[model samples]
Target: MSTLTHHKKSVRAMAQHPKDINSFASVSADNVKKFNLPNGEFLHNMMSQQKTIVNAMAVNRDGVMATGAAVFALSYDVTGTRLVTCGADKTIKMWKKDQNATPETHPLNFKPPKDIRRF
Candidate 1:
Protein backbone atom coordinates (compact mmCIF):
# COMPACT_ATOMS: atom_id res chain seq x y z
CA MET A 1 0.00 0.00 0.00
CA SER A 2 1.06 3.55 -0.62
CA THR A 3 2.42 5.42 2.38
CA LEU A 4 -0.40 7.93 2.17
CA THR A 5 -3.15 5.32 2.30
CA HIS A 6 -1.34 3.54 5.09
CA HIS A 7 -1.62 6.52 7.45
CA LYS A 8 -3.76 5.83 10.50
CA LYS A 9 -5.48 9.21 10.68
CA SER A 10 -7.93 10.28 7.96
CA VAL A 11 -10.62 12.93 7.91
CA ARG A 12 -13.15 14.50 5.57
CA ALA A 13 -12.81 18.22 4.88
CA MET A 14 -14.70 21.06 3.22
CA ALA A 15 -13.45 22.25 -0.14
CA GLN A 16 -12.63 25.89 -0.50
CA HIS A 17 -11.43 28.24 -3.23
CA PRO A 18 -7.66 28.04 -2.86
CA LYS A 19 -4.96 30.53 -3.81
CA ASP A 20 -3.31 30.64 -7.21
CA ILE A 21 -0.24 28.53 -7.92
CA ASN A 22 1.41 31.21 -10.03
CA SER A 23 3.84 32.94 -7.72
CA PHE A 24 4.97 35.50 -10.28
CA ALA A 25 2.55 38.39 -10.39
CA SER A 26 2.47 38.81 -14.17
CA VAL A 27 1.80 35.20 -15.03
CA SER A 28 -0.89 34.86 -12.43
CA ALA A 29 -2.61 38.06 -13.51
CA ASP A 30 -2.47 37.14 -17.18
CA ASN A 31 -3.90 33.73 -16.45
CA VAL A 32 -6.63 35.20 -14.32
CA LYS A 33 -7.53 37.53 -17.15
CA LYS A 34 -7.11 35.03 -19.97
CA PHE A 35 -9.22 32.44 -18.19
CA ASN A 36 -11.82 34.82 -16.83
CA LEU A 37 -14.80 34.05 -19.02
CA PRO A 38 -18.42 35.11 -18.84
CA ASN A 39 -19.18 31.54 -17.88
CA GLY A 40 -18.79 30.63 -14.22
CA GLU A 41 -17.47 27.16 -15.01
CA PHE A 42 -14.43 28.52 -16.79
CA LEU A 43 -13.65 30.80 -13.87
CA HIS A 44 -14.00 27.99 -11.37
CA ASN A 45 -11.68 25.81 -13.41
CA MET A 46 -8.83 28.31 -13.38
CA MET A 47 -9.14 29.00 -9.69
CA SER A 48 -9.43 25.45 -8.37
CA GLN A 49 -6.88 23.80 -10.64
CA GLN A 50 -4.07 26.10 -9.59
CA LYS A 51 -4.50 25.07 -5.98
CA THR A 52 -3.10 21.65 -6.86
CA ILE A 53 0.39 23.13 -6.83
CA VAL A 54 2.96 21.60 -4.50
CA ASN A 55 3.16 23.81 -1.44
CA ALA A 56 5.37 21.58 0.66
CA MET A 57 7.86 18.84 -0.14
CA ALA A 58 9.92 16.43 1.92
CA VAL A 59 12.70 13.92 1.24
CA ASN A 60 12.81 10.75 3.23
CA ARG A 61 15.59 8.54 4.58
CA ASP A 62 15.51 6.57 1.34
CA GLY A 63 16.02 9.91 -0.43
CA VAL A 64 12.69 9.82 -2.21
CA MET A 65 10.72 13.08 -2.42
CA ALA A 66 7.07 13.82 -1.74
CA THR A 67 4.88 16.93 -2.03
CA GLY A 68 1.68 18.46 -0.75
CA ALA A 69 -1.10 20.64 -2.16
CA ALA A 70 0.23 24.12 -2.82
CA VAL A 71 -2.49 26.60 -2.02
CA PHE A 72 -3.94 24.68 0.90
CA ALA A 73 -2.54 24.12 4.38
CA LEU A 74 0.07 21.54 5.43
CA SER A 75 0.97 19.66 8.58
CA TYR A 76 3.75 17.33 9.70
CA ASP A 77 4.30 14.77 12.38
CA VAL A 78 6.36 15.57 15.50
CA THR A 79 9.41 14.04 13.89
CA GLY A 80 8.70 15.85 10.63
CA THR A 81 8.79 12.48 8.93
CA ARG A 82 5.12 12.25 8.10
CA LEU A 83 3.14 14.88 6.19
CA VAL A 84 -0.49 15.86 5.88
CA THR A 85 -2.29 18.12 3.45
CA CYS A 86 -5.69 19.66 2.85
CA GLY A 87 -6.59 20.68 -0.66
CA ALA A 88 -9.42 22.30 -2.57
CA ASP A 89 -10.96 18.85 -3.10
CA LYS A 90 -11.81 18.88 0.63
CA THR A 91 -9.76 15.76 1.23
CA ILE A 92 -6.94 15.56 3.74
CA LYS A 93 -4.15 13.36 2.42
CA MET A 94 -1.23 11.95 4.36
CA TRP A 95 2.12 10.68 3.23
CA LYS A 96 5.39 9.41 4.68
CA LYS A 97 8.51 11.39 3.96
CA ASP A 98 9.55 8.89 1.34
CA GLN A 99 6.22 8.62 -0.44
CA ASN A 100 5.53 10.41 -3.71
CA ALA A 101 2.37 12.35 -2.98
CA THR A 102 1.22 14.24 -6.00
CA PRO A 103 -2.05 15.91 -6.74
CA GLU A 104 -4.27 14.47 -9.47
CA THR A 105 -6.18 16.77 -11.74
CA HIS A 106 -9.47 15.75 -13.33
CA PRO A 107 -10.05 18.20 -16.14
CA LEU A 108 -13.52 19.48 -16.78
CA ASN A 109 -14.77 18.53 -20.24
CA PHE A 110 -17.10 21.40 -20.81
CA LYS A 111 -18.81 22.95 -23.81
CA PRO A 112 -18.82 26.65 -24.59
CA PRO A 113 -21.63 28.63 -23.09
CA LYS A 114 -24.75 29.08 -25.12
CA ASP A 115 -27.06 32.03 -24.72
CA ILE A 116 -30.77 31.39 -24.32
CA ARG A 117 -33.48 33.74 -25.55
CA ARG A 118 -37.01 34.03 -24.32
CA PHE A 119 -39.69 32.66 -26.65
Candidate 2:
Protein backbone atom coordinates (compact mmCIF):
# COMPACT_ATOMS: atom_id res chain seq x y z
CA MET A 1 0.00 0.00 0.00
CA SER A 2 1.16 3.52 -0.80
CA THR A 3 0.41 6.82 0.95
CA LEU A 4 0.34 10.40 -0.31
CA THR A 5 0.98 13.63 1.57
CA HIS A 6 0.92 17.20 0.33
CA HIS A 7 -0.12 20.78 1.12
CA LYS A 8 0.23 22.55 4.45
CA LYS A 9 -2.87 20.99 5.94
CA SER A 10 -3.44 17.96 3.77
CA VAL A 11 -1.68 14.63 4.26
CA ARG A 12 -1.79 11.40 2.27
CA ALA A 13 -0.99 8.65 4.75
CA MET A 14 -2.13 8.62 8.34
CA ALA A 15 0.83 8.41 10.66
CA GLN A 16 -1.16 7.36 13.75
CA HIS A 17 -4.37 5.76 14.94
CA PRO A 18 -7.67 7.55 15.26
CA LYS A 19 -7.72 8.77 18.84
CA ASP A 20 -10.68 11.09 19.46
CA ILE A 21 -13.26 13.26 17.73
CA ASN A 22 -10.51 15.66 16.70
CA SER A 23 -8.96 13.48 14.00
CA PHE A 24 -10.07 11.85 10.74
CA ALA A 25 -9.73 8.17 9.92
CA SER A 26 -9.59 6.65 6.45
CA VAL A 27 -10.98 3.24 5.53
CA SER A 28 -9.90 1.83 2.23
CA ALA A 29 -8.61 -1.49 0.87
CA ASP A 30 -9.22 -3.12 4.26
CA ASN A 31 -6.94 -0.68 5.99
CA VAL A 32 -7.85 1.89 8.59
CA LYS A 33 -5.40 4.77 8.70
CA LYS A 34 -5.60 7.71 11.07
CA PHE A 35 -5.17 11.39 10.10
CA ASN A 36 -5.21 14.60 12.07
CA LEU A 37 -7.49 17.33 10.85
CA PRO A 38 -5.47 20.19 9.44
CA ASN A 39 -6.68 23.75 9.90
CA GLY A 40 -9.90 22.18 11.09
CA GLU A 41 -11.01 18.55 10.53
CA PHE A 42 -11.87 16.30 7.62
CA LEU A 43 -11.49 16.77 3.91
CA HIS A 44 -11.22 15.05 0.46
CA ASN A 45 -8.32 13.10 -0.96
CA MET A 46 -7.37 13.32 -4.63
CA MET A 47 -7.07 10.25 -6.84
CA SER A 48 -7.68 8.82 -10.32
CA GLN A 49 -9.24 5.48 -11.37
CA GLN A 50 -9.34 4.63 -7.67
CA LYS A 51 -5.74 3.46 -8.18
CA THR A 52 -2.94 5.86 -8.88
CA ILE A 53 -0.49 8.14 -7.14
CA VAL A 54 -2.71 10.81 -5.62
CA ASN A 55 -1.87 14.14 -7.17
CA ALA A 56 -2.65 16.65 -4.41
CA MET A 57 -4.05 16.92 -0.88
CA ALA A 58 -5.42 20.03 0.79
CA VAL A 59 -7.37 21.10 3.85
CA ASN A 60 -10.81 22.57 3.55
CA ARG A 61 -9.90 25.54 5.67
CA ASP A 62 -13.00 24.51 7.55
CA GLY A 63 -15.04 21.24 7.16
CA VAL A 64 -17.33 19.22 4.89
CA MET A 65 -18.73 15.86 3.61
CA ALA A 66 -18.50 14.03 0.24
CA THR A 67 -20.01 11.32 -1.95
CA GLY A 68 -19.97 8.89 -5.00
CA ALA A 69 -16.22 8.27 -4.79
CA ALA A 70 -13.16 8.80 -2.73
CA VAL A 71 -12.62 12.55 -2.63
CA PHE A 72 -10.22 13.65 -5.33
CA ALA A 73 -10.29 17.36 -4.58
CA LEU A 74 -11.37 19.78 -1.87
CA SER A 75 -11.92 23.53 -1.56
CA TYR A 76 -13.49 26.01 0.83
CA ASP A 77 -15.14 29.39 0.82
CA VAL A 78 -13.22 32.49 1.84
CA THR A 79 -14.90 32.43 5.25
CA GLY A 80 -13.95 28.77 5.70
CA THR A 81 -17.60 27.87 6.12
CA ARG A 82 -18.53 26.26 2.81
CA LEU A 83 -16.77 23.11 1.54
CA VAL A 84 -16.52 21.46 -1.82
CA THR A 85 -15.11 18.10 -2.98
CA CYS A 86 -14.54 16.17 -6.19
CA GLY A 87 -14.60 12.38 -6.24
CA ALA A 88 -12.79 9.76 -8.30
CA ASP A 89 -16.03 9.09 -10.13
CA LYS A 90 -15.99 12.63 -11.41
CA THR A 91 -18.75 13.81 -9.11
CA ILE A 92 -18.43 17.11 -7.37
CA LYS A 93 -19.91 17.46 -3.89
CA MET A 94 -20.63 20.56 -1.84
CA TRP A 95 -21.56 21.06 1.80
CA LYS A 96 -22.74 23.95 3.93
CA LYS A 97 -20.86 24.41 7.17
CA ASP A 98 -22.66 23.61 10.36
CA GLN A 99 -22.42 27.03 11.88
CA ASN A 100 -23.44 25.63 15.28
CA ALA A 101 -20.71 23.03 15.57
CA THR A 102 -17.12 23.86 16.25
CA PRO A 103 -15.41 23.81 12.86
CA GLU A 104 -12.23 22.16 14.05
CA THR A 105 -14.02 19.33 15.84
CA HIS A 106 -16.95 18.79 13.53
CA PRO A 107 -15.82 15.97 11.19
CA LEU A 108 -14.90 13.85 14.18
CA ASN A 109 -18.62 13.36 14.73
CA PHE A 110 -18.93 11.49 11.44
CA LYS A 111 -16.51 8.61 11.14
CA PRO A 112 -16.43 6.89 7.75
CA PRO A 113 -17.98 10.10 6.46
CA LYS A 114 -21.21 9.79 4.57
CA ASP A 115 -21.12 11.50 1.22
CA ILE A 116 -24.19 13.58 0.42
CA ARG A 117 -24.71 13.65 -3.33
CA ARG A 118 -25.15 17.11 -4.79
CA PHE A 119 -28.23 17.08 -6.95
Candidate 3:
Protein backbone atom coordinates (compact mmCIF):
# COMPACT_ATOMS: atom_id res chain seq x y z
CA MET A 1 0.00 0.00 0.00
CA SER A 2 1.08 3.57 -0.65
CA THR A 3 0.79 6.43 1.80
CA LEU A 4 0.60 10.15 1.15
CA THR A 5 2.11 12.53 3.70
CA HIS A 6 1.59 16.01 2.38
CA HIS A 7 -1.20 17.37 4.54
CA LYS A 8 0.13 19.81 7.13
CA LYS A 9 -2.82 19.31 9.48
CA SER A 10 -5.11 16.46 10.32
CA VAL A 11 -7.17 15.41 7.34
CA ARG A 12 -10.88 15.79 8.00
CA ALA A 13 -12.23 14.25 4.83
CA MET A 14 -11.19 12.57 1.58
CA ALA A 15 -12.81 11.77 -1.75
CA GLN A 16 -11.62 9.96 -4.83
CA HIS A 17 -12.31 11.48 -8.21
CA PRO A 18 -15.38 9.82 -9.62
CA LYS A 19 -14.16 10.21 -13.19
CA ASP A 20 -10.42 10.04 -12.73
CA ILE A 21 -9.20 6.90 -11.04
CA ASN A 22 -5.74 8.38 -10.77
CA SER A 23 -6.80 11.48 -8.91
CA PHE A 24 -8.13 12.26 -5.44
CA ALA A 25 -8.54 15.04 -2.91
CA SER A 26 -8.11 15.53 0.83
CA VAL A 27 -9.29 18.25 3.15
CA SER A 28 -6.86 19.61 5.69
CA ALA A 29 -8.07 22.51 7.78
CA ASP A 30 -9.62 24.83 5.22
CA ASN A 31 -7.65 23.66 2.19
CA VAL A 32 -8.51 20.99 -0.29
CA LYS A 33 -5.45 19.54 -1.94
CA LYS A 34 -5.30 17.30 -4.99
CA PHE A 35 -2.92 14.44 -5.42
CA ASN A 36 -1.97 12.02 -8.17
CA LEU A 37 -2.48 8.33 -7.76
CA PRO A 38 0.15 5.56 -7.84
CA ASN A 39 3.01 8.03 -7.49
CA GLY A 40 1.07 10.04 -4.88
CA GLU A 41 2.56 13.33 -6.01
CA PHE A 42 0.92 16.54 -4.91
CA LEU A 43 -0.84 18.23 -7.79
CA HIS A 44 -2.35 21.45 -6.48
CA ASN A 45 -4.90 23.02 -4.16
CA MET A 46 -8.52 23.11 -5.24
CA MET A 47 -10.24 26.48 -5.21
CA SER A 48 -12.33 27.07 -2.13
CA GLN A 49 -14.07 30.05 -0.57
CA GLN A 50 -14.66 28.34 2.75
CA LYS A 51 -12.99 29.63 5.91
CA THR A 52 -13.49 26.72 8.29
CA ILE A 53 -12.41 23.14 8.50
CA VAL A 54 -14.08 21.06 5.81
CA ASN A 55 -15.98 18.09 7.16
CA ALA A 56 -17.20 16.50 3.98
CA MET A 57 -16.34 16.16 0.31
CA ALA A 58 -17.67 14.56 -2.85
CA VAL A 59 -16.77 14.29 -6.51
CA ASN A 60 -19.09 13.65 -9.41
CA ARG A 61 -18.72 11.60 -12.53
CA ASP A 62 -18.15 14.76 -14.53
CA GLY A 63 -15.20 15.76 -12.32
CA VAL A 64 -17.12 18.37 -10.38
CA MET A 65 -16.14 18.58 -6.72
CA ALA A 66 -17.98 19.67 -3.58
CA THR A 67 -16.70 20.52 -0.13
CA GLY A 68 -18.49 21.47 3.06
CA ALA A 69 -17.41 22.77 6.45
CA ALA A 70 -19.58 23.05 9.56
CA VAL A 71 -21.82 21.47 6.99
CA PHE A 72 -24.23 18.67 7.46
CA ALA A 73 -24.13 17.39 3.90
CA LEU A 74 -23.00 17.91 0.31
CA SER A 75 -24.06 16.29 -2.94
CA TYR A 76 -23.78 16.43 -6.70
CA ASP A 77 -26.70 16.40 -9.05
CA VAL A 78 -27.31 13.33 -11.17
CA THR A 79 -26.08 15.25 -14.21
CA GLY A 80 -22.85 15.97 -12.42
CA THR A 81 -23.11 19.63 -13.34
CA ARG A 82 -24.30 21.05 -10.04
CA LEU A 83 -23.22 20.75 -6.42
CA VAL A 84 -25.27 21.51 -3.32
CA THR A 85 -24.09 22.01 0.22
CA CYS A 86 -26.02 22.62 3.43
CA GLY A 87 -24.24 24.11 6.38
CA ALA A 88 -24.93 24.72 10.06
CA ASP A 89 -25.59 28.35 9.31
CA LYS A 90 -29.00 27.21 8.00
CA THR A 91 -28.05 27.99 4.45
CA ILE A 92 -27.91 25.92 1.32
CA LYS A 93 -25.47 26.85 -1.41
CA MET A 94 -25.40 25.61 -4.97
CA TRP A 95 -22.38 25.82 -7.20
CA LYS A 96 -21.70 25.47 -10.88
CA LYS A 97 -18.56 25.79 -12.92
CA ASP A 98 -18.35 29.01 -14.92
CA GLN A 99 -17.61 27.91 -18.44
CA ASN A 100 -16.72 31.43 -19.49
CA ALA A 101 -14.25 32.03 -16.70
CA THR A 102 -10.63 32.12 -17.80
CA PRO A 103 -7.31 32.28 -16.05
CA GLU A 104 -7.06 35.93 -17.01
CA THR A 105 -10.36 36.68 -15.35
CA HIS A 106 -10.06 34.29 -12.41
CA PRO A 107 -6.39 34.10 -11.69
CA LEU A 108 -5.21 31.49 -9.20
CA ASN A 109 -2.55 33.61 -7.59
CA PHE A 110 -4.85 35.76 -5.49
CA LYS A 111 -3.57 36.25 -1.97
CA PRO A 112 -5.27 34.41 0.85
CA PRO A 113 -7.28 36.36 3.38
CA LYS A 114 -5.06 37.89 6.06
CA ASP A 115 -7.35 36.56 8.80
CA ILE A 116 -7.77 33.11 7.33
CA ARG A 117 -7.47 30.37 9.89
CA ARG A 118 -5.53 27.15 9.46
CA PHE A 119 -5.00 24.23 11.72
Candidate 4:
Protein backbone atom coordinates (compact mmCIF):
# COMPACT_ATOMS: atom_id res chain seq x y z
CA MET A 1 0.00 0.00 0.00
CA SER A 2 1.25 3.53 -0.74
CA THR A 3 1.42 6.00 2.13
CA LEU A 4 -0.24 9.37 1.84
CA THR A 5 2.09 12.31 2.15
CA HIS A 6 1.56 14.81 4.97
CA HIS A 7 2.01 17.77 2.63
CA LYS A 8 -0.58 16.49 0.18
CA LYS A 9 -2.85 19.25 -1.02
CA SER A 10 -6.54 19.17 -0.22
CA VAL A 11 -8.51 19.33 -3.46
CA ARG A 12 -12.17 19.12 -4.32
CA ALA A 13 -13.93 18.17 -7.53
CA MET A 14 -14.75 21.10 -9.80
CA ALA A 15 -17.07 21.23 -12.80
CA GLN A 16 -15.84 23.05 -15.86
CA HIS A 17 -17.85 24.56 -18.70
CA PRO A 18 -18.57 22.64 -21.91
CA LYS A 19 -15.51 23.94 -23.78
CA ASP A 20 -13.39 25.18 -20.88
CA ILE A 21 -10.30 23.41 -19.62
CA ASN A 22 -9.14 25.93 -17.03
CA SER A 23 -10.89 26.00 -13.67
CA PHE A 24 -10.62 28.51 -10.84
CA ALA A 25 -11.07 28.35 -7.05
CA SER A 26 -10.02 29.96 -3.78
CA VAL A 27 -7.18 28.26 -1.96
CA SER A 28 -4.89 29.03 0.95
CA ALA A 29 -2.27 27.57 3.33
CA ASP A 30 -4.76 26.99 6.14
CA ASN A 31 -8.47 27.46 5.46
CA VAL A 32 -8.14 27.86 1.73
CA LYS A 33 -10.79 26.08 -0.29
CA LYS A 34 -12.60 26.02 -3.59
CA PHE A 35 -13.34 23.88 -6.68
CA ASN A 36 -10.77 24.46 -9.39
CA LEU A 37 -8.52 22.66 -11.80
CA PRO A 38 -5.57 20.71 -10.50
CA ASN A 39 -3.15 22.70 -12.63
CA GLY A 40 -3.38 26.44 -11.79
CA GLU A 41 -4.26 29.12 -9.26
CA PHE A 42 -6.88 31.33 -10.85
CA LEU A 43 -9.30 32.01 -8.02
CA HIS A 44 -6.68 32.47 -5.35
CA ASN A 45 -8.04 35.88 -4.46
CA MET A 46 -11.66 34.90 -3.74
CA MET A 47 -10.70 32.85 -0.72
CA SER A 48 -11.07 33.54 3.00
CA GLN A 49 -14.75 33.60 3.88
CA GLN A 50 -14.18 32.83 7.57
CA LYS A 51 -16.37 29.84 6.87
CA THR A 52 -16.72 27.02 4.36
CA ILE A 53 -15.98 27.36 0.68
CA VAL A 54 -18.33 26.81 -2.20
CA ASN A 55 -19.42 23.33 -3.23
CA ALA A 56 -18.97 23.44 -7.02
CA MET A 57 -17.68 25.80 -9.71
CA ALA A 58 -18.29 26.20 -13.41
CA VAL A 59 -17.72 28.60 -16.27
CA ASN A 60 -20.80 29.84 -18.07
CA ARG A 61 -21.29 29.55 -21.84
CA ASP A 62 -20.24 33.18 -22.04
CA GLY A 63 -16.94 32.31 -20.35
CA VAL A 64 -17.80 33.66 -16.90
CA MET A 65 -16.68 31.75 -13.84
CA ALA A 66 -18.98 30.91 -10.94
CA THR A 67 -18.77 29.36 -7.50
CA GLY A 68 -21.33 27.27 -5.69
CA ALA A 69 -22.37 28.44 -2.27
CA ALA A 70 -24.36 27.02 0.62
CA VAL A 71 -27.54 27.12 -1.41
CA PHE A 72 -26.90 28.75 -4.76
CA ALA A 73 -24.03 29.70 -7.03
CA LEU A 74 -22.28 32.99 -7.53
CA SER A 75 -21.82 33.92 -11.15
CA TYR A 76 -21.23 36.92 -13.35
CA ASP A 77 -23.38 38.10 -16.22
CA VAL A 78 -22.29 37.72 -19.83
CA THR A 79 -21.33 41.39 -19.91
CA GLY A 80 -19.69 41.27 -16.48
CA THR A 81 -21.92 44.07 -15.37
CA ARG A 82 -23.08 42.50 -12.12
CA LEU A 83 -22.07 39.81 -9.68
CA VAL A 84 -24.85 37.33 -8.90
CA THR A 85 -24.57 35.07 -5.88
CA CYS A 86 -27.29 32.97 -4.33
CA GLY A 87 -27.21 30.55 -1.44
CA ALA A 88 -28.40 29.75 2.08
CA ASP A 89 -27.64 33.34 2.89
CA LYS A 90 -31.18 33.86 1.53
CA THR A 91 -30.03 37.01 -0.15
CA ILE A 92 -30.07 38.20 -3.75
CA LYS A 93 -27.55 40.93 -4.18
CA MET A 94 -24.90 42.10 -6.61
CA TRP A 95 -21.31 42.44 -5.56
CA LYS A 96 -20.53 44.84 -8.39
CA LYS A 97 -23.46 46.65 -9.94
CA ASP A 98 -23.20 48.74 -13.10
CA GLN A 99 -25.23 51.90 -13.42
CA ASN A 100 -24.50 52.52 -17.09
CA ALA A 101 -27.67 52.69 -19.12
CA THR A 102 -26.23 51.28 -22.31
CA PRO A 103 -23.84 48.48 -23.07
CA GLU A 104 -21.09 48.61 -25.68
CA THR A 105 -22.13 47.57 -29.17
CA HIS A 106 -20.83 47.66 -32.74
CA PRO A 107 -22.40 50.38 -34.83
CA LEU A 108 -21.34 49.13 -38.24
CA ASN A 109 -23.69 46.76 -40.01
CA PHE A 110 -22.31 44.00 -42.25
CA LYS A 111 -24.84 42.74 -44.74
CA PRO A 112 -23.81 40.41 -47.54
CA PRO A 113 -25.44 40.41 -50.96
CA LYS A 114 -27.25 37.30 -52.09
CA ASP A 115 -24.92 37.08 -55.06
CA ILE A 116 -21.16 36.91 -54.43
CA ARG A 117 -18.36 37.53 -56.91
CA ARG A 118 -16.09 34.58 -57.52
CA PHE A 119 -12.39 35.04 -58.03
Sort every candidate by lDDT, greatest first: 3, 4, 2, 1
lDDT of 4 by residue, 5-53 (tens): 2212454324454454554333223223333355443443333432454
Residue 43, candidate 2: how far off, in angstroms? 21
Candidate with the larger lDDT of 3 and 4: 3
Which ranges of candidate 2 are over 4 A from the true structure? 1-57, 60-69, 99-119
Count of clashing pairs, candidate 2: 4
TM-score of 2: 0.32
Top candidate, metric TM-score:
3
TM-score-wise, the better of 3 and 4 is: 3
- Output the TM-score of candidate 4: 0.33
lDDT of 1 by residue, 1-119 (tens): 21212112232221122132221110121121112212222222122123333444433333323334433665555555777777778788876633443344434564432431110
lDDT, candidate 2, 21-48, per-residue tens: 4665443432223345444333443221
The best candidate in terms of lDDT: 3
lDDT of 3 by residue, 1-119 (tens): 77788777778788888867897888878467888888888887775445577788887886656666788678888888888888889999988889999999988885765543321
Please say which candidate is ahead in lDDT: 1 or 4: 4
Of candidates 4 and 1, the better by TM-score: 4
Q: Sorted by TM-score, highest first, which candidate order results? A: 3, 4, 2, 1
Query: In terms of lDDT, which candidate is stronger, 2 or 4?
Result: 4
**How many residue pairs clash per model?**
1, 4, 0, 2
Summing lDDT over every window of 10 consecutive residues in candidate 4, give the lowest-scoring window: 110-119
